[model samples]
Target: MARSLSKPARTSLLPWLGLAFVIILCDQLTKIAILRVFSYGESVSLTSFFNLVLVYNLGAAFSFLASAGGWQRWALTALGLGAALVIIYMLQRHGTQRLFCTALAFILGGALGNVIDRLAYGHVIDFLDFHLNAWHFPAFNLADSAITLGAILLIFDELRRVRHGSR
Candidate 1:
């Protein structure tokens, strides 16, 4: 059976929600700066292995459905917004769980950041570029970074929970 929290032990979701807000703010701010400073496809070399390039993704990660025309744009926006709602719900329920809430907050922030871009520009702005030799990875933004980090943390949290045999 799972242990229950007493009234005094219950935690609020406000803190985690604030963290999500911060993430979203940072993500959007950077995107705004990139949009204002860089033109489409413009790249500024930051290092031998990396460049700052402005790009827009109309589809999901890796531009999964980028060529599918305009329908995918609304579809992706709806999906992201829906995911954010669900994540908020999850966070409200598990606010006392630090790792879980952190992961959800990251996802919620990233999803909101991308959704905002999709709504405002019909695409997500990406600028970070990494390349080595002949290989070049796709450009991504801080929102994507937070989401990736959150996923890794989620996996680690699950592993830890499993090892502890806690339900």
Candidate 2:
């Protein structure tokens, strides 16, 4: 006969939560500074290939559904909040997975930042434009950056898991 083992200890998820909060804080603070300094549609050259611009995104990535009038505002806000809640739950469940948790943290922060923007200004504030020659990428902010990075990290983590034979 074998003795039964007790349950594993519950590890706190505060560190990951703190990282998300810090990302959100930085994203919002930068947006506030840009709002104070730049007028709408303002663009200032930051480098040969970059610019600091003020633009409002009433839609999602690449301005998807941006021309849908006022309805997208509420729709996007609800979507973002929903994503945040889901990411929080994922973080809670997989907090020990460092890369996965970190990615989720970033996504959570970015989603909340956009949600706050939607609530306060009815749109997302974007700056940091990049361009080359006649082509220009969409203007974006720190929150967008975080979300993009998170997505890339998620892909990398998935690849690593496959390589290591972990599901």
Candidate 3:
């Protein structure tokens, strides 16, 4: 049987795409601002809990596989592309579902933001840092925030679906 598009699908997808585009704009603008303002590895403590630390990550979060003599760059680039494709597919298929569409928008924005970084600089730019006395958390940026937010939204969406009998 052929599937038909519905009005609800158009409404949800349009806003999802708009949100993703807005996210991309914000992520890129912040990265550019940080690049122009901060020297690499420079840190400006904003509070006892946070700082803006400029750093480039040649690998994934926490610098995973960063020391693999550079092979991981290509590997990770490929992985990101694959994930982007999967996400786009999900957006196309489930864009009528409000929560699902929101999750996909976040993922799409984040994936594209990092992809732009890898292509332009061969690494991802990270600036946000949270720390305490001698302890530190990994620095990240808008793109990372979106990806994490997307994952959380996905979980919330699932829970909501279950509760609402939409499962």
* Top-scoring candidate (lDDT): 2
Q: Residue 150 error for model 2, in Å?
A: 0.5
lDDT of each: 0.90, 0.91, 0.86
Model 2 ranges with Cα > 4 A deviation: 1-10
Model 1 regions more than 4 Å off: 1-10
In candidate 2, the residue pairs with backbone N, CA or C atoms under 3 Å apart (3 or more residues apart, or in different chains) clash, namely none
By summed lDDT, the worst window of 10 consecutive residues in model 2 runs over: 4-13
Cα distance off (Å), candidate 1, residue 109: 0.3
Whole-model alpha-carbon lDDT for candidate 3? 0.86
Candidate 1 accuracy as TM-score: 0.93
Backbone atom clashes (below 3 Å) for every candidate? 0, 0, 0
Q: Candidate 3 lDDT, tens digit per residue, 64-112? A: 9877788877888888889878877777777777788888889889888
- Rate residue 70 of model 1 by lDDT: 95
For model 2 the local lDDT of residue 23 reads 93
Model 3 ranges off by over 4 Å: 1-13
Instruction: Put down candidate 2 lDDT per residue, 78-159, tens digits, no spaces.
Output: 9999998898878877778899889999998898888899999999999989999768999999999999999999999999
Model 1, CA-based lDDT: 0.90
Reference-based TM-score of each model: 0.93, 0.93, 0.89
